[model samples]
Target: MTVPAPAADGLPTRVRIHEVGARDGLQNEKATVPTEVKAEFVRRLADAGLTTIEATSFVHPKWVPQLADAEALFPQVADLPVDLPVLVPNERGLDRALALGARRVAVFASATESFAKANLNRTVDEALAMFDPVVTRAKADGVQVRGYLSMCFGDPWEGPVPLPQVVRVCRALLDMGCDELSLGDTIGVATPGHVQALLTALNEAGVPTPALGVHFHDTYGQALANTLAALRHGVTTVDASAGGLGGCPYAKSATGNLATEDLVWMLRGLGIDTGVDLGRLVATSAWMADHLGRPSPSRTVRALSHKEQ
Candidate 1:
């Protein structure tokens, strides 16, 4: 394995990698991964130095049966000294997460009416309306909330989402008391310029860079590039999955997320500290790939693990 020499670009000194392998990554699995396996996956991700790992979603089993064991799984890894944010679709999901002592929760929103209807069976504003009390209650309880704005860049149904539309929903989430927002390129259609433009637009809309995180999918192989553009614009937090293990369950065109190993490798090369152990992350994803009976899709994971083989 070759480590790229540290080359400090005009980027943040340290970036936070929000690990989503356990929750978003596994939610699309056709076979139900045992609860114990999911628990171990989260544990290993924490051990690999990912500070914030999304644990599971509280969505109904009818919607995402893969994470039906959120109750059984949360307590299993709750003691770990890390941020285990769970996804809560509505007030009901928030209740389930708070019951298990989850301190951080995220609400999934869409930037387009098409995705809003397809995923949540509501209009864009209606979905945000549903999350209004959920965010309010979570903030009232002192729980940190993250607003995940999916289809921020492009929608499979409505191609090329408008920037103002994205900024509007983002401001609504922030005004509604979300601690931060994760802008999701749900279909992986964003380019570097699009990423920068959106960030600038968000900043002009009074959504500070610190309050934003970028979640890019690799369906178009542009996640890393888009991330670089964000970093150059003073955004530090990035959302990725170990071994690149995730896709939108509602959007069939969506593909695996930006791989944690791939993101770490780029950040490490650029002399950006992420507090992640690339070796352990690759190993963890490899272990999970074995569990799923498939090869990991992450290029860096494959490259590093192949050298060991």
Candidate 2:
């Protein structure tokens, strides 16, 4: 595939793509992946020039059996030169990640009450309360903590999540010592306008654009559009999965995340630097798709790999 000519449209010169294939991408798989495969996936993503790769969650095995080997998996990829951030669901999860020498960790929170209850069995406030110490202790240990706020756009149980409701949870996370926040369109119901509006509201609510990341789902085929809106608003960090590999296991309506290959294609066309080699990224996703026994859902992956064949 030919690279799109550089076009500067007043966007950030460089965008950080948080690769989530190893963790969020494979978390919901019904079939268990070997620990070695998961480790190799992380290695390949880093090799593709992704700096920050979410490795694995420290959540309990019973809840997510696919990542039961977190202890075994984390150690194998701990020596990589990239930023390997793991998900820590609570204080105990934080302890688990810290024990394995994880320097960066993330906590998942919900912007709406229904998703809070469905995912964590806690109220909105109760869930934030759960993460208070997780963020506190992680910061105390000098670890970088990223707060993930899901259902920022729409919820399955609740139709449209209010802008203020999402802003409140984001504020709570930052106030609790989270180094940054990732706004998640859990059900993928966000549009470019909604994304811009929310970012503006958060800015007004004292959330800096630099401290924010956007995670969009492609359920409505709006992930890239929503992402462009964020970029125009100065959001430099974006969360995406290789080969479109993730969905909310808790939210049935949620679909695969924004494909990293697709996002890179867009950024490259726009003259935004992401340090990613598109050829290598597509190959990695194709390799992963082969391992999963399915064709990659990423359009760029399909298009480029098909021409190679």
Candidate 3:
């Protein structure tokens, strides 16, 4: 298939960025970021033209103590012009989120049993079953739900996952009324070949490609390559974090999600318009990295800063 040419304006006409830095990014941090800092980060992200930001998770504080402030923080930024989605681990988490007037929530699952058990404390079937009530309740309450499937490419414990397993979970999520499904390369082991093959399998199974999204970590530095493969298959929505903010706690040495600035830069180069200001996003990422006392993991940020120097 011939890749489409760049737009007349020298960018793709559109792209969607789901910012998870605030929630997934900070969830594993050793230090608890003050509520004010989290709020400020969300506000700055909105100002950077991000329409979908994963603000926080409402799971039990014991599992992820960093996001214990979801309730307190949601109300403070309820007026922002963006979909601030919080991760809801179960019905109880859903209840907390609903109390805070959450309009969007995400449910997560894993393809492998071991990862599922370690991360979500359930088997694959059990985890998907848990979402039934959560999705139903969220839909009834007029809240949109997004589904996430981790270990789409390969699992650290289970090795490479079967294509049918990924397709089945995806179909289940979509059938359960999830607005979208984000296929995650949790350990960053997906290659362009695997991406193409899995997407093809998903499409053949009657799944709508547009309703599918890809989330790649740069552990193997293949996030961009996998993204290109997804785009080639007409997959529209992509999940990325600013400054490359999140990593898998279960997999040591694994890097965070694909960087938003880098993703935006690539999309712009391919003529896709993400509606994000590249320079502003880079600056915001830099500021956050500084505030967090760590240099950004984004190659785009490093390159741009180097160019300026």
Candidate 4:
């Protein structure tokens, strides 16, 4: 296969999308998904050629009741042909993940104090401090760690988060031994200009775009536009959900992450290779949407489903 190089505009001809439908997507759902269904969801995603599938979170049931079955779900998808990273909020969550033999885990940190307090019940610095030990022990266990920095662009409580604050948190996470950073537009308020400006600032701050993954929410219908900006900056990793499946519980105004199928559609149009089969992916999302008892928010899935008539 001839790998295409970057375009004249500098967008890479290939991108690796991090699939977050199982953990991040289902976590926000009010109705509880059966443990078996959740496992099957992860299986379908891996079968669709998703290289990195976030299987489940080891968060407390009281906090996220939907993913309370993380321990149960992880065992089922652990052997898939992909990197199955589970979310670990603290030391305890990490313990559960490690005991289940998780080879890769994710720790989430917030850029804004309000989101930190709301989601983690700790101040920004306090939360990072809490994650420090988790990262440390995960390292000892030889588990790959992916750091998620939420509210990188905007926060519902604070609104319009500054770049420096985001940079500080991101740098701190990298300093704490996070293998990669996933910058999240939690409230989905970022435009392409904002995305570009932030990536530029992060690059200037010593964090390369290669180590950063752009996670956008399509709330304002800017997910694709902002994603183009990230691509133009040479970003390779993107966090997208199957069927556009989730929203932030803490950020009530937040919507779902960029749909994986939608991202693939744009990348393929730009002649970018994602190694994901768009038709199989859409069918997966459509099937998932049916299970959730709602039509998918993904335009690609909707358009294809409409055409099947």
Tens digits of lDDT, candidate 3, 243-274: 89989888775779899988988887677877
Off by over 4 Å in 1: 1-7
- The sequence of per-residue lDDT tens digits that candidate 1 reaches over residues 56-156 is 99999999999999999999999999999999999999999999999999999999999999999999999999999999999999999999999999999
Q: How well does candidate 1 score on lDDT at residue 90?
A: 98
Q: What overall lDDT, based on C-alpha atoms, would model 4 receive against the true structure?
A: 0.90
Candidate No. with top lDDT = 1
C-alpha lDDT score of every prediction, in listed order: 0.95, 0.94, 0.88, 0.90
Whose TM-score is higher: candidate 2's or candidate 3's?
Answer: 2
lDDT of candidate 2 at residue 53, scale 0 to 100: 97
On the 0 to 100 scale, the lDDT of residue 301 in model 2 is 98
Instruction: Tell me which of candidates 1 and 2 scores higher on lDDT.
Output: 1
Where is model 3 more than 4 Å wrong at Cα?
1-5, 8-12
lDDT of 4 at 142: 86
Supply candidate 1's per-residue lDDT for 27. Answer: 94
Off by over 4 Å in 4: 1-9
What's the CA RMSD for each of the models? 1.0, 0.8, 3.1, 2.3
Looking at candidate 4, what is the lDDT of residue 252?
Answer: 85
- Candidate 2, residues 1-309: lDDT per residue as tens digits? 556666577789999999998999999888998998899899999999999999999999999999999999999999999999999999899889999999999999999888899899999899899999888888999999999999999999889998999999999999999899999999899999999999999999999999999999999999999999999999999999999998999999889999999999999988889999989999999998999999999999999999999
Q: Please give the range of 10 consecutive residues that has the lowest summed lDDT in model 4.
A: 1-10
Report the backbone clash tally of model 3: 5
Q: Order candidates by TM-score, high to low.
A: 2, 1, 4, 3
